[model samples]
Target: MTEDFINYYRENISKKSQIIKGVNDFLVWGKSQKINFAICTNKMESLAKNFLKKLILLSFLIILQVLIPLNIENQIQDI
Candidate 1:
């Protein structure tokens, strides 16, 4: 499933997906209203950036965050 998703993202996302209606306008409006905006994704950092780049929205975006999980044991250190 992961491979299929990755393959589809690479092969089709840039070529096929359409932005939802009013999306850019919404973002702009949000900014005008002093509302912060962000793009959050579970995908790898590179993939997320590439997606924004493909959408031609990278330059307009303020920030995007990708949440990657780390091993629980690595999350903290006990002395």
Candidate 2:
């Protein structure tokens, strides 16, 4: 079941935007309800932290991609 969930996420929801949005929504809902959240993955703490950092970076990149044209075209014009 764990593998299946991971596979489904990899195949259908690999985009960082999706991951970030899902996590963000969950956190917001949890906070509103005063619910504490904890991650229980089998992954090591370092690995999990790295994964989360990557997701955050990807989400930030996606946001920049959308906003750069309007706000910083001069900086990223080469790309």
Clashing pairs in model 1, backbone N/Cα/C closer than 3 A: none
Models 1 onward score TM values of 0.60, 0.38
Give the Å shift of residue 21 in candidate 2: 5.8
- Tens digit per residue, CA lDDT, model 2, 1-79: 6556544554444254445347677666766777655454443233344555656532222112122243434432322
**What C-alpha lDDT, on a 0 to 100 scale, does residue 29 get in candidate 1?**
85
lDDT of 1 by residue, 10-61 (tens): 6665676667999888877877888776788766666677778888677666
RMSD of each candidate relative to the true structure: 6.9, 14.8
**Most TM-score-accurate candidate:** 1
After superposing all C-alphas onto the true structure, candidate 1 shows an RMSD in angstroms of 6.9
TM-score of 1: 0.60
List of clashing residue pairs for candidate 2: none
